[model samples]
Target: MTTSTTDSSTPAPGAAASTDERIAVVNPATGLQIGSAPVFDAAAVAELAARGRAAQPGWEAMGFDGRALVLRRMQQWMSDHADELLEILQAETGRVFEDSVLELAYPLTALGHWARNAEKYLRPQKAAASSPFVLSRRLRSYYRPYGLVGIIAPWNFPITIGFGDSIPALAAGNAVILKPSEITPLSIEVIRRGLEECGMPEGVFQIATGAGATGAAVVDVVDMVMFTGSTATGRKVGAQAAQRLIPASLELGGKDPMIVLADANLERAANLAVFGATVNSGQVCLSTERFYVEEAVYDEFVSRVVAKVSALRQGVPVAPGSVDVGAIITADQLEVIDAQVRDAVAKGARVLVGGQPVRGVTGRFYEPTVLVDVDHTMACMTDETFGPLLPIMKVADADEAVRLANDTRYGLAATIVTRDRARGAELAGRIDAGTVSVNDMLTHCFALGLPMGGVKTSGIGTRHGAAGIRKFCATKAVLVAPSFPNADIHFYPANEKVSPLLLAAVTGLYGTASRVARATPRALATARRLRRELGR
Candidate 1:
């Protein structure tokens, strides 16, 4: 996790062209460029993609065990250099040190999960046909690598989200080109260096840094694209991949909700709600944005939320005594947050806690806001407000809670806090989300064994677990017969005897069991006549 200052002339291994134009990677807290990233032109991206394609076969030849060894090396490298990586993450994203540290575990976890399971997941599996005719034939599906992959990552959690998809893609044996968010390319570069140090082949994993054009280039050139960002941008990415007719997996916007039942632990529920809403300053896709509390415990829940939020400390990303919140990413994002808050207040929503930007913070900082009396008409309740704003609305009962939770267009995740495990499980089945957490917020996401993805506008395809690795592969069915010399009864001739017998056999196999009993005798007699006529 070290930074290197490069001039326009000296291009890094897979960096963009040497244009005078550059993107400055700024530290949000200090409002200064920590490092400048190259703006890759179309040509540079093409060359990078070509290099990745050329290097893929050799890497693929490494096999699952070989790739797993490399992944383990990367994990050990990150562990050995955890402190330095944390410093770079904090400097680039302005996230609290604890939050950044928490994200670091995901990469190692993903790498380990894939390394441990890739062979089993991708191995050829028998898809035995149930029909009696094909019972003796061998039919299996083998997972084939997609050759090359392009990843467009968001800036929210640079280390985790930026390179998360790449781990499984590499494990599945495809070369990858990562187009990290221009704002936070530093951590990605740190990852690139670790891969290099682990003795991974050149061009197997590359980074192309720039804005939208760079990402577009990646989508255009690669065989597959995995994008993590806003829904609007994901649509554009999907369209681009559509032009090439290549596959894409998108992890997009989320307006996640939290449902509080009356029987739940009020204190635990409120504490988790505050953490879920404000974690990473609410930049996370799965961060709980809406709260639906049962009327019986609504007031108590709101009170607990205000108390917890009030005690949250905000400052530089990395400081002593555990900073709870960090600076917002940029000025434009801050403006969006402000506008949403203003709109909600104007529409009769009541702000229960801090609602404006923090009074004395030097950099991009917004106070953790809590809103009550919020209705669906308010933008803060419906749209994605990627700031530290928690909106609580009362529900008459569990029915209303579930209804309000599923009312959104996005269904990435939902949380239910309940003491009744059976009741919670039942309600979880009804919630139209990719993941429903019972008495928890984001624990499911970290559980790499379970697949994670979104429904509707949230995302396409899943990440982590076995599905994550398999998504990067194309399943090819392989079928084999005992012998090709022995021709079938339906080979070519339109014989009078075989035709009616074939129909009877079809009817017998597909129709009722009684029909099979009646048809079998005639079909066998026809087969004897046909065999004698064929000179056998």
Candidate 2:
């Protein structure tokens, strides 16, 4: 990875000078060049992978305790340098200060969580045999590291998703090569430097900074791959990993829905809907994109949502509280947001608040938008609109709300809002998503003990909890028999007497009630035959 530096002559954001082998980094809010990173080719990535492979053994040999120490130090380092890290995050992604703070805070929690729990989660476990025939045998299982792991992170939450995912892979004793999205790659470099300062061994954790080809190279060289991106890109990554026969875990696209029942607190439901849909400029995979509210309260809910969205402060994030919402991460994303809003309007949806890009702003930004009269026929309701656009549809009842919620191909997450907790939870269970939050939204992702992942086109496999760390490992099962006869009855003498005894013993152990009592005598006779065969 090249060191970040500002150059006035460098091309604007999104313009990579491939001939010069560099990707120009830009501050999305200002649309100005912030720095440039080397566009590493396949050969460079292979060399980095080789170095990581060589260092992995030593890192793994350090044991969980040693690794945890380094991780703990990193936590302190992050705390000490939170402001500096937050700055890089803000500059590259153009997210609000509060959103950037989340990107910083998540890794701190993840570092501590994975450091403290990895050994316990990956520890060997004794297995019990189900059959009486294997009672004398001991069975155990343990995990082994995959040696090297590749993580391809999207641009939205560079630190939270990129470094956060690496924590568990590192804890599981694997070397990590993170290929952060070129759009927002600067923040990860800061993390790599912090890890080195915290006594992380060289080559154990490295960043491969470049575009899609760079990510592909990392996937080609690593033992396993974890990807966070669009469903289209995830499919390619999944296919590549499959061709290599390596394990792949994907966190893909989502068109998360919010269901508001008639019994819901209208104020609270509307507040959550606006925040969940517009936070981080609505770039989150788990963000609520579409809403289904009970028709009885639909007009009131839409009114409240529009009021809140209109009150939002959209601007460049200069500091904490500088803006309630920040610039869109890329120009391309701005277009997507505009296109979706237009498509919804064309399909007879009414824009209750914002409906287009903010004017008089040099930075790429979309207005925090709210739409009513939306249905499954509109792209904004059915497709992934990863921007600050919320389109709500009226449902006749909870059943209709559920039907609309499950209407999407993406099943990453969904939210239910109701005053009756039990009813909300029941409806949550019926929603087809990997995670369903009742009376809440987007908070389940922070609970490190709970697993998070998408289902269907949203993603495959999971992150967090035991599945997170264990996915970076290979399981080994060990079975031992402490005692055995010199020539076991089943082992090779081809004895007719031994076969008859074995059959009788099996009959006594598992036969029906009618024959069980009578088979005991036959079992006793078999025991005598076994003793004679053993020369006892």
Error of 1 at 376 (Å): 0.2
TM per prediction: 0.94, 0.93
User: In order, what lDDT does every prediction score?
Assistant: 0.85, 0.86
Quality of model 1 by C-alpha lDDT:
0.85
lDDT tens digits by residue: candidate 1, 1-536: 23333331124565545456788777786676677777777888898888888999999999999999999999999999998788888878888888887889889888888889999989999874655456458899899999999999998888798788899999999999888888788778878888989989988998888899989988888999999999999999999999899999999999999999999999999988999988888888899999999999999999999999999999785463568998898787888788888988999988888899866656788889999889899888888878899999999999999998999999899999999999999999999999999999887768888888999899899887778888898889888888865777577768988777888866655566676667768775654454444333
Per-residue lDDT tens digits for candidate 2, residues 167-259, read: 999999999988888898877888888898999888898887789998999999999999999999999999999999999999999999999
Q: Which candidate has the highest TM-score of all?
A: 1
Q: Cα deviation of 76 in candidate 2 (Å)?
A: 0.5
Off by over 4 Å in 2: 1-20, 514-520, 524-536
Superposed by TM-score, candidate 1 places the C-alpha of residue 266 at a distance from the truth, in angstroms, of 0.9
